[model samples]
Target: MEQTSLNLVAIAVFVMTLSALLSPALNISPFIPAGTTLGILTLATLDSVSWGGRGLTIFLDLFATPQQRQRVIHHEAGHFLAAYCLGIPITSYTLSAWEAFKQGQPGLGGVQFDLTLLSDTKTIQKTPLIIERTLTVLMAGIAAEMMIYDNVEGGEEDKKNLRAIMRIMGISNSLYQQKESWALLQAKNLIIRNQTAYDALIEMMEKRASVEACQSLIQEKINQIEVMT
Candidate 1:
């Protein structure tokens, strides 16, 4: 499924790039703003390639050092750990561009979850637990990064995650700054408690596990948690 999506994205990019290259030669007015066109195409390509894998992998060879990759592993592990603890189902995870290209979604790497609970119309009246758990899960990635690296990079994605959580909690963006620190702290605690799961996740990432592998790993972890509790 992911491979097919990536092929489509690659074809789109090729067509757009070809059109851009040929426009001047054909004596035609540029049909689109070149900068905007390239920017959109770049984002689309990135999203398409990185959906189920680590977004950083695409640029890892060009920009990231070994330490940075380790940091990303921990960062993503934090997210996977927290979501698992919160009873969210993880569909897949990856740490390679080819995997992302195969899954073909967007942004950098991501841990896909079952959002069916959020979609339950009967649960329309939201609860505090839901809101808090959601925010903690969203902040878990950055918290994990900070825990290992003592700093953070690529936080824009985290902020977007936070914003979405806040929106779901019925809080406005204006209130995010006031609430973010506490949410991050909570996420850190969740990550700490689930350290074992985090470790397993990092190991899987180091192996460049594919979506199916990730799914199986997460399911096994979830079962372990279920048995323990």
Candidate 2:
């Protein structure tokens, strides 16, 4: 997927460059933006593509402003915070789809927990508690976006991930909707409950804290929350 996406991006860049070169002869200024739009549109239309998937995400990342970068940091921090509160050990996190692509990870960006811990205990089963915690983590990014922007758009990948997990558990559509809503509410409540710690973690993450630094920050915040409650 990564190679295929890299190839597609290379082709798109080539097309856009060719269009830019020809724009002078055609006396068209819109040609460059037009070609870029066309490239993005083509990538968007592919059935294999998800919102933050490799092909078009790199384009989005290229044009993302500083505010957008901060938003991604906050979004990822939400996942890390929620997981930490739930006792999930985060192994690493990324703030850019491009970074995730380089790491051979799916989705735009995310906090990766150490799921390998489960392997030592038992076969990881899709029990109710697991599903609930998973849903909360899945919706935490959306919750963060909604809190800051009054809207959310980056959770498409999260929703897709949730659906795939639910499918494995044989969850019904109605139950899925209920669980999603419940989990989102839980995530929002947790964020609200731990707002100070969450904000501190976001600041730490925005500064490009390393994995060990992030884990330390996470633990500190979680400990504070525990003391408070």
lDDT of 2 by residue, 1-229 (tens): 4444555556677777777788889887955667675765476557245544466666657777898888888888889888888876677787877878877776465788776534432343635576568778889999998998898867877888777767666678878788778888999998998888789889888776887787687678778778878
- Return the number of clashes found in candidate 2: 0
Model 2 regions more than 4 Å off: 1-56, 116-126, 225-229
Question: Using Cα atoms with residue i matched to residue i, what is each candidate's TM-score against the true structure?
Answer: 0.62, 0.72
User: How does model 1 fare in lDDT?
Assistant: 0.68
Instruction: Return the top candidate by lDDT.
Output: 2
In model 1, the runs with Cα more than 4 Å from the true position are 1-63, 119-124, 209-229
| Per-prediction tally of clashes | 10, 0
| Global fold similarity of model 2 (TM-score) | 0.72
lDDT tens digits, residue span 1-229, model 1: 2443455456567767887888889885666645555675575566556543234335432455777667767877787777777866677764444455467745455666676666653463456676567677778888998887788874577778677666765778778887788879998887776666677878887887764665567668767987999
